[model samples]
Target chain A: MSLFGRQSKRDLHSLAAPYALDALEPHERARFEKHLRTCDRCTAEVRALSEDAVRLAWSTAAPAPLAMRDRVLAAVRNTPQEASPLGAAPPRPHHLPAHVWGTEPPPPRRRAPRMRPLFAPLATATAAAALVVASLFAVQATRTQDQLDTARAQSREIANILAAPDARATNERDARGRGIGVIASAKEGRAIVTLSGLGDLPSGRVHQLWLMRPDVQPRSLGLFQGDTPLVTSGMNDDATSLAVTVEPNGGSAQPTSQPIAQLALKSVGFGE
Target chain B: MEADELLVRVAGGDQKAFEELYGLVSGPVFGLVRRVVRDPAQSEEVAQEVLLELWRSAGRFDPGRGSALSWILTLAHRRAVDRVRSARAATEREQREGMRAHHPAFDQVAEEVEAGLEREWVRHCLERLTSLQRQSVTLAYYDGYTYREVAEQLSLPLGTVKTRMRDGLTRLRECLGGVA
Candidate 1:
């Protein structure tokens, strides 16, 4: 579907050029990105268009000021290079379908002819068991590695957002005067909610964050547990306030209880 | 070494390769940033950030995707556009209205930058596109206007601008492919 409505395949394909040129709006760009992952034709078209755009970019080549060379080179000297290529690859989707690990049992292996030595079958059985155990360990290791990579990438994104010149934070208090801190960047469309001074919730309940905009329905940002800061992105640009509510675990489609804390967001100059 | 090879070495902490890569890309990066950012000082600053990011994220460069030049330029453009948008967003309403009135002058500056044989060829290709297509592509790519802004500027519908840009770029790509 198009960002605003259903789009025909041709309409989606037409987005490749604008997408490559970085001309689409944020929401439209996002929708086209989702479409790009599954559409080979559009993907190839975008790649080709991007290469052309680079040429177009090069056509505007005015010499950079001579002073920049020394500064950049000096900075490079002071910086340490990456130790590995772990986070270089785009994060692969980690979810695996349940059916991938087929439910049916393998057919029993046919018995070797009577002439075959008994020890051979016994050795094969032992090797098979060993292989199965090894494979299981390998899968577990890979899953752990994927999770580590994801966490590392996320931490990097959070750090960048926090470092943004426009990043702003506000401390909010509930009716009971508990603190909830919020850090947000409107340009980046990201926010981090930090729960502080709020005691642990009882079982079967969670804290859900909502973005309230003038004349717009409150939209759920996310649900979180524990006191750690939760990072959220793709926030509505017009949201003027943030709120937290107690909801049933797994989060409600809509708020079911009064907000525990609320904070009005003040616009801060970003990218200064 | 090629840009990709230099990037790999840079990833492995080769300062020499990093310096060489900087020499290769810094001009185009600065130029691209200047197109979108307008202010030379701010463009230079943004270019520095983009180059620094390239050094820091060299290991993440996936050669299988595209050439190193395209990737770096893409990043430069993104940073430049972000700077422009954020700066505009911060200005008061009257100031933004004033900016909208004068935004078309930026396109003239873009046109004036086209020099040399290579640029002349590009200009030729660009001119070959219909006026609407040219305006849409130039405003979006060079002036850093979003499709919505382009539509609004041209007094055309959003869908019309999208189609024009796509068709325009497709033709430009085909033309450049032949020349390259």
Candidate 2:
């Protein structure tokens, strides 16, 4: 945002009310804000009026669609934030490619195998490390630097979730043998998924993730291009498992196909 | 944790802090946007933009400047108004208003019990303002109208509408301030 606007020399004090209510037009707002910098009394009044405006805002509280949480969080994870003048920079550690999968293997604390099989040969693996200094949730190792650069803010998030005390991993393999690793933190109500050995998708199809709750409709986490690590948040208490479905292009609001892989979270039905 | 504390963490790029913050603020942000923008789809889009902006600009938040909730709502309201002012959105909004006149809007579901009480409290506070003051504030705020437009809508003098808005908001601040 531009810190300074074209300074208005004349008395624009009467504009304060219209300004606070956002009744002023753009140029008018700039002049008032500019004038406000010099006038402490006006600033004090605007601040008080704005607090009332917040109350007006609160009076109309509406629940955003429940699904929006995951979308926004997913977006937040990848989106780079602007610098804060007051903030000390948070450490952002890169997950070196070699640290993923095989090196310094995290003890697999394999939980109950909640499986829905099209065919019966089930396989399971869990990566429950002391912390995620090494891999399993490697969006970095698998994606291009451009993709990784975009997710600079998220690299730290992926690390934090993986290292969370409640963090534990569960693995599932698709029909084509692509492995999807989900490391979830029940305490944080978030998850990071790493897809490795992904096969090419048909032109119109994409992979979509869902939080499969027992009685309610599944919540779509987001669509994935199948190359990067996926991070999703706002997992409520009832969501029993994570499911992946093949969806048509922009992705369906609801899962359109049978889940290629379903792995129960470490919740009630997931008896160890 | 307080919104300021959470915002500090968010500025430092903490996703979990951002999550808790989102839970607290999304309702007001989305509701206020919908109040001005009218269409649910467009409102959602605008709300998302505002939330993303909060992330991108978290570092710019100054605790001394204002409360986090006020700062966020101000940003949301400004964005919603900007959308309505755009030529295309302004034209589309007129059509929607005309259509809405014939077919009344479907009632939006009331949210949680806690939020209901807050709304009731604010409603009670709003009742304390004079009718003209309340009309001026609501017309400009909820309708996303400029002072000129509000004056036209209320058929009052511009100066009169401006004074009413200021008085209404001042009274509203003290009344709501007691509870908050």
* DockQ for every prediction shown: 0.25, 0.41
Docking quality band of candidate 1, CAPRI definitions: acceptable
Q: What's the TM-score of every candidate structure?
A: 0.55, 0.56
Candidate 1, superposed: residue stretches over 4 Å from native: A1-11, A81-272, B92-109
After superposing candidate 2 on the true structure, give the runs of residues whose Cα lies further than 4 Å from its correct spot.
A1-11, A84-272, B87-89, B92-115
Model 2 chain A: lowest-lDDT 10 consecutive positions: A111-120
Q: Candidate 1, residues A43-89: lDDT per residue as tens digits?
A: 78888888877878888777888756755664454333334332222
Q: How well docked is model 2, in DockQ terms? A: 0.41
Which candidate has the top score in lDDT? 2
> Per-model i-RMS in Å?
19.4, 13.9
Which pairs, if any, clash in model 2?
none
Comparing only chain A of model 2 with the true chain A, what is the TM-score? 0.48
User: Candidate 2 on A197-231: residue-level lDDT in tens?
Assistant: 56678889998888877788999998886566678
* List of chain B TM-scores, one per candidate: 0.89, 0.83
In model 1, residue pairs whose N, Cα or C atoms come closer than 3 Å (at least 3 residues apart or on different chains), thus clashing, are A88-B60, A166-A270
